[model samples]
Target: MRERPKIKDIAERAGVSVATVSRALSDSALVTAETRQRILDLARELNYRPNVSARSLRTRRSMSVLLVVRDVGNPFYLDILKGVEATAREAGYSVLMGNTESDPARETEYFNMLRDGHADGMILMTGKLPPAGGWSHLPVVVALEMIEGAGLPHVQVDNIGAAREAVEHLISIGHRRIAHISGPLPELMSLHRREGYREAMRNAGLDVPESYEVRGNYLLESGQECCRKLFTLPEPPTALFVANDEMAYGAAYELRRMGHDVPGDVSVVGFDDLYLSKAFYPPLTTVSQPRAEIGHVAMELLLKILSGAEIDCDEPIILPTVLHIRGSTAPPRQ
Candidate 1:
């Protein structure tokens, strides 16, 4: 077997001193750009990989970032994971996925990893704030979801605006008796989306009877249960605006089970157009946020923080959302 290529070999082949090669590999400003490029080119040609463990001992950086997700099993997180992984690799960093499963204990365990230098930084998708003290110095970025008053850098979408637009789409198609299936009310995203739903309803002069809104856990089961409750109302809703695609799938599934044709008997809209949304039965109409972009941008922001750049955490970086009109929605039957 060929011996692993080393910086020593690149140094000899590039006709530079080992010290110069070292500086060049690190991209230290002390090395001229021309010399750095030459060394880098030679390293690439030789497949000369850096000894990360040795470098970590010298620099005290694990050179990996942690991505803490509320639930790694959720399909919604897949795109974001791709984005994060891609960006991290380009920057010569590896990623650690911390699946907290929404458990405070697991979250704290991952937080300890960051504090202990197992990872250089963290991109938080758990939608929860860290413990109050000793976290002021950690490099952390929040993604996809927001934590109000957390004072951390964020990469998220306009939940309220996106949700309002979704509901507005239903209203445009003559859906007056519109109901909402929301994520857990305690979540800020859910609250913002629910607010958007209410705002659109209020704007259209529609009375949202208490029965028209149901709290769901952003799961298919909750969507099914919520849909059952809503249809039992004295005046069933003509349409539904679900907070996430999973719940929307559940809602649509239940609608079929109850002998209703989607968009003919009732229209439905969902947020976060997961990959499955396009292939699901009737192809759900939903709001599509830049899920992967959210991960990419969040990782970039964390990298900036890790590089000692002073990032202002005061305001979040908000991305846009697109409302994809699909077969699940249309003009509501009068």
Candidate 2:
């Protein structure tokens, strides 16, 4: 086998300087797109490989960001992760992953990895804050979840508005006694959504029945249990709005198990229009959060921090949400 080609050899063969070849290979700003493409083609032809470790040492960057989520398998988070992955790859960075599985201790352990420089930056998608011990001085942290005190900047959607919109959609279709299956109460996201539900009900001059709203953990089983509680009430709600898609599926499954037709006997709306929502038995109507865009924007903000760019702390970035109406929602039975 022949020896592997070096950058110098590629530069000589391409008739460009080593610096030009380097910029072309890395797709740097200095190299025009045409020049970069030509250099890249030559490198591919010559089978030249870059020494990532050496380059990292020279640049003092790992060129990687950490994305920590509670459940990596969740479809909503997965879409967001894909967005983050694509954006990071385009920005010439790799993504390091950490799964907490909702375990706070594991989350704390993973967070410690950031302090030791395991990743250039971190995108935390878990709702739990750092362990109540110490760790109040890390850089470039974004709370993609409802976690408070992340000690870094963040990007969040209007949970209140999104929830209100979902609820209002149900009401516009003549749903008065609508119930909400809420996520964890202490979480800012959940609290905001719950408040939105209450606010919408109050604004419409309807009685906000405490018993109609049930707390959940954003889990399937919690949703099922909440559904059971709502159905058992003396007066059941004709419509339900679940906090997330996973729970919405659970509510739908449980409702079907009871021989109730979705959007026929009851209408349902879910949040975080995950991929699963579209493919579900009856496509779920939900509030679509800019899942991947959230990840991309957070990473971009972190990149700005890494570049020593000053950001105004008072102004937090807020992404918008949309309502995706599907087969799951309709006018409640008159």
Candidate 3:
């Protein structure tokens, strides 16, 4: 078997001290850029790999971060994942992903992994903290959603204000009877969005009847079912503000199945302006979230915490949202 090259070999070949090679490999700012590059090139030429296990045992760090999200299948999370992986790799760290599917047991298992030093820190998109009490001391950053009372560093858009803007757009298009299909009530983002919807209606002097609000599980089936229920009303809503793009797609699909012309019969608006939203029959008018930026900022915050940097938990990082006017929304027919 061919022997693996060690750091000493790279240092000797690059004509640098072992300490300089170590600093360069770890991407330390202390290392001169030119010297670092030379050492890196020689290391690559020698096919040298760092002893990660030895480093972990010595430093008490796994040199990896974990990201726990609620639904890994959602396309909306793809951009976020990309941002996380990119940033982590640049920082000389690895990322481990966990999909909790809203299951507490799964979430707890991931938290346990963090505690066991499998990861140096965690970025949570699940919006729920671990049931275990020891996690407070561990480095964690919440992303794309907020957890009430957790006092953790969070990265997300202003969901309430964004939802209000979406609903307000529907109203601007002469949609007086606007209905909202919200995400599950337990989720903080869902509640913020629902509140935004109601606020917009109240500001416009539009009466939001009890029947206008429906709870969706942030799933396509729930969106379809909610739309069906809304359409059954004697005076159905002419515009819909769905909580997310997937639900918006489902709502549009169900609308067509029931003989409704997309923007002609009922203008539709969605959140999360996912990549597929533009390719749907009619492009969806929706709120565009900075998904990748949110992920990047969240991971950055987690890295800061892991480095013992102080973060003000009182002020959460809130990114802005834009309303993309697309073909799915138009002025209601007279």
Task: Evaluate residue 328 in candidate 2 and report its C-alpha lDDT on the 0 to 100 scale.
Answer: 95
lDDT of 1 at 80: 92
Task: Give candidate 1's TM-score.
Answer: 0.88
Regions more than 4 Å wrong, model 2: 1-50, 149-151
lDDT of 3 by residue, 162-199 (tens): 99999999998789999999998878999999999999
lDDT string, candidate 2, 1-334, tens digits: 8887899999898899999987665545566778878887787788677776887898776778888887877767776777788867755678988899888888888767776666777777776666575654555555546655544577888889889888988888899999999988888889999988888888888897889889999989988989999998899989998999889999999999988899899999999888778899789999998888898888767766665556655556889999999999888776
TM-score, predicted candidate 3 vs. hidden true structure: 0.87
Put the candidates in TM-score order, highest first: 1, 3, 2
User: All models: lDDT?
Assistant: 0.88, 0.81, 0.89
- By lDDT, the best candidate is 3
Model 3 residue runs over 4 Å out of place are 1-51
Best candidate, TM-score: 1
Give Cα distance to truth, residue 185, candidate 3, Å: 0.3
Off by over 4 Å in 1: 1-48
TM-score of each: 0.88, 0.84, 0.87
Judge candidate 1 against the unseen true structure and give its global Cα lDDT, from 0 to 1: 0.88
